[model samples]
Target: MPVDQETTARDGDTPDDLGSVQYAQTAVVPMDPAHLERHRVVAHQKAHPASWAFDVLRTQVLQKMDESGWRTLAVTSPSVESGKTVVAINLAISIAQQTNRTALLVDFDLRRPSVARSLGLNRPKSLNDFLDGHASLAEALVNPGIERFVVLPTNRPVNSASELLSSAKVGKLIKDLRERYSDRIVIFDLPPVLAADDVMSVLPRIDCVLMVVGSGVSTQTEVEEAMNRLSKANMLGVILNKDESPTQNAYY
Candidate 1:
């Protein structure tokens, strides 16, 4: 994969920019006071009667993961713009609000990362950067005004995003996060499974793969095809987005 060089600006560097770099890195950024309001808004946007379904879904996921001893999780869909990022982010936020538990949101969608942007944080160094050795984990993680919750945003789109995600370094990164944040939840916002093999490559590393299917859009055939490509089936589940049926709510 082609790599870019990291650049740090002078004292008067632009507030909106974080210099130029080849690959993104994971860093520990202090939480800003303003992040609290942003967190509330994010939480509020996710808070709905439909959200109760996710609360139930979360319990089910935890039950399955607990039985299998899985920690890391990958949230994805079959196509782009399927609300996977929003589901993953909201789920992570809800998990973080569990009193003493922590939650870490890892934006693994190098193709189009927007987790940090949505949370009002600067674009961050990504898993690709950390795995490629362009930056350290401590340099990429940020606090978006929530206690015990952190985000690792993908800073730039790299040509070899797929290869980087499938690399051993990415595996090691997941392991390290689980260890360091043993008290926290690690949620990975992955690229769409059908968009690339990135989601499939990282599935085995996670405890479960939550597949978000757009209601009235995703066909059963497409979902079956994607499921067939997966190595494990027990860690898989379907999340229907924007369904009209009472049994098929948005959270499920």
Candidate 2:
């Protein structure tokens, strides 16, 4: 469906509109370029050389997804501090840069949600509110001054994340997001497969899964187990991150 009509860019929205609105009522909060830089989120920064890496990954991901006819992508890792969230964010930014695509990055790591902090977002309403029945999905979305990109961030942790993720409501949420809009890639940043049962709980609802593994952070056993758990999923390839072996940039 097309974005709601009469949706004008709100205050703090990026002036670089695509001559279209992806989210009519979504809050458009300008992201601080410096803060983004500090957090190593640079895919949207054309001048930053580091962005090229994400662009390449973006191309490969898009190609695979298009070929497989997949719509929802779940990104996770073997363990914590594997930089899965960072990869997901940059990939979303790169995808959003495409003239024909819009990107929706959803923070589904309910136990330790960090997409908002990683993106320098501090707002009132978020995924927590939506799950708690206090806010609508549209009200929980935020455009971080990046045209064609919106974020559904979770501001707090939920103790019953695994149960909630597998519930009918969460399934409906994923289905709605996947089928609602045209040319929109919905990326869900999920908890690690080894971290909890959360990833497995939500895996079946997602179309495909991407694993991000930090070179020195994840153990062979952990990686193997995670892959085993995801053996039934439509694998979207694994990302090797945080390895300094590569020249200058270490993330894929």
Candidate 3:
């Protein structure tokens, strides 16, 4: 599907006026461009060259998801520091920028949740609190100054993350998030596939998976191993990140 024209039309409207009617139920949080730059989140920075990469990624991902009838996507990497979180954040932002669909990003990397930090959000109640029974899902949802975008961030690390991820509660949470709205695309930022069993535990619950690999950081063996682990799920594709070739800038 092509990018929606309504997104461009609504770009000039104030956040309050844009979100007041349709997204009144969502908590809106303003995002600072400088803060986003620090975290390498460039999707909202449309003028940046890096932003186009994410826009292209978003289009391709959405086309495959649409063809496969998939709604929930889990973004993970073979190991840490592979720019998977950055990819997840940017891809979600790009998706939300499209007017036809609402994008909901969930920080499911419970052991090292960083989605809130990447977006410069200091939310007290998040996915952590919701999973611990301290807060409701509604209380955990936040809109980070983007139309058609919502985030369910995790504030801190959780104990027994693997167990929690594989638990019935998480299953129900994923089901609810997916079924709540037909026009919504839910993206989950999962832990590294080779770092822990967290990704494996949650893989079966999501509709599709995307693997991000950093150039020169992950070995061929590691990538193969990660792919082996992800073979059971509907593999969306792998993202090659931090590529510094003369022709390619960073992510591909």
Candidate 4:
């Protein structure tokens, strides 16, 4: 509902005090340089010039979050294949590129987790471990060679995702993540709003949400239904994705 001033992308402007991965408690992993150029990642750069869409999206989304004092953001779609996960990853990377804040991308889509795969993180310890009580939160976190970027990836799909999202354990997890750091933006890559009750289950625990609607993927009725479901959410704008022409990709 509120907005802050826009800022430059400045891809490598992460703060000097943010510290390096070598000293971080989270496990540091290497992301293939080819992943971004492979079309899965959209971190705008010289190699993938058209990926600047994520930078603009990040600026706008972060502006609203900063103004509203929101620390967590949920990224979801009306239905499947709307590029929500990709958007989440790119936004996290784009935000981490800034000088003031750090970004943590969490794969909260327990049903069909893809953040690890999308980032080329091979079987890293993840949310599955944390949820099963086999690992601590720090053990589940992964740094994909990005200075201020961290990820809590889900290694596999979990049963009863909606119920899991509503549990007390998850509630405490969200609270801890929110209060852990003063200048961290935690982004959750969630399931489609219309596909399941997972979004509604966890929406209350999050600060705000960004909807991704794929072009020609969902009907007008479906979009309307999904929006009505989010009537109470702190709705950030919707993204028009899956356009055939990259230049015509719509961010608003």
Candidate 5:
């Protein structure tokens, strides 16, 4: 797979006649095979039945986003353990795998960032460092060994996560990522809507939102409250995850 580098002008740097800027670039890092298998990151494992579900999800999600001219998607749930992160990761991988689109998965759940762990990536420099002014956006991106797929993982929890998400830096970051590439789909694995205010703080910056509800986990009241909170945001749809119904698969 070819890596596309987007450059920017530095201090005192001049742009070319074509208006192209010169800057440092980042490359993809290979992921561990064993680690991926251990964590059930099966989207890349095309032979797995679970991978098909994500492919279906990817088709629907991309269609909606394209119809609305939306590029950034935030995946959240009513509460913790609702498998939002899993859905986010798998959806991204499936999109990248099935289409020419580039899928960028961002771990924006600063309170309990798990995208890296779930993808079996080590403590690579991530969004925590980027937001703290210790790393650049390119430095924070990891390829996770998937073609046309990248990830901005958060290695640890941050204090005042809601405030951080609401900060100007975060807003700029979101804008930059969204506008960086027209063909790229940036998916944010945000914290549960009811677990913290972080989701609400960042929801406005995202193009659309997707709620993941685990079967038998989220209560009716909890779902209603989540819907109320997201009423103002452009909600793409709700995903019913971990379904055990004999008639349907695990995910819907």
Candidate 6:
């Protein structure tokens, strides 16, 4: 099934007459360049046990995800405040640095949209507007500070985010995005699996899942039980959140 042409383009929306749509943010903001440099430093710090392990970990993650034909991935954790949002945003920034590849970081944790706040973006258009036919995807996307990366921040808190995610409309939207941006990657910062069934709903729609586990915070039992709750087996993996002591953990 194809998304209707009428649906893709909004009614009464005419193409901007030769640069009329030009905006200062998209035109002047060097979001991509700055974001990559920041994330490169951050990844270095996270990946290595030394001062710059994050960079190495970032590279490893990119390589692994690339090798697996992964484009749409859900970043989740066992519970909230586990640094899942932090990892998702930084990982998306790191991945967007790849040559000729763009990354779309979507905030699907509709119940608590911390990605936008963490990034300092104020009340941006959200996944709700896009899913509810209130805004076009492009209109909802913000360039932020990265050229190859765009973010769809969830500005409004939804009452039933899980239901919306599981709807047929969401499946079709994600499918269209995957096909449209074959060269780009879509990273969703999903709600915690144990906290809600939102991630479970979108499990079948995404390419893979990256479980973010906070060091000293997430227990083995929680990780295992969360994995058992997911629908697909191979789609899941783990990214450990290191502590000041640099302790590491793993997930399925």
**CA-lDDT, candidates in order:** 0.64, 0.83, 0.82, 0.79, 0.80, 0.66
By TM-score, who's the top model here?
A: 2
Q: Model 3: which residue pairs collide?
A: none
Candidate order (TM-score): 2, 5, 3, 4, 6, 1
Clashes of 1: 13
In TM-score terms, candidate 2 sits at 0.88
lDDT of 1 at 68: 74
Best by lDDT: 2
List clash counts for every candidate, in order.
Answer: 13, 0, 0, 0, 0, 17
Candidate 3 local lDDT, 1-252, one digit each (tens): 112212221334453331212333567788998998888888887888778888888989999999988999999999888888988998999998954798999999999999999899998789888778786666678888788888989999987999999998889788867765678899999999998899989888899999999888899999999999998999989888856321132433
Give the per-residue lDDT of model 1 (tens digit) for 1-252.
Answer: 111111233355454323222122223344443663443224423544545555566677776766776678888887776667767876776676653666788998988887776666664455556566786554565655555666778877766778877777777667656654345568899888788877767777777778888775767887777777764645457787774322243443
lDDT of 5 at 108: 91
1 or 4, which is superior by lDDT? 4
135-251 per-residue lDDT for model 2 (tens digits): 766678888887888899999999999999998878877876776565889999999899899999999999999898888899999999999999999998888885632113343
Shift of residue 119 alpha carbon in model 3, Å: 0.7
- What's the CA RMSD for each of the models? 9.1, 6.5, 7.5, 8.2, 4.0, 7.1
- Please give the lDDT score at residue 99 for candidate 4: 43
TM-score of each: 0.75, 0.88, 0.87, 0.87, 0.88, 0.76
**Clash pairs for candidate 2:** none
Q: Is candidate 3 or candidate 5 better by lDDT?
A: 3
Residue 14 deviation, candidate 5, in Å?
9.1
**Worst 10-residue lDDT window, candidate 4:** 1-10
lDDT of 6 at 11: 41
Global CA lDDT of candidate 6, please? Answer: 0.66
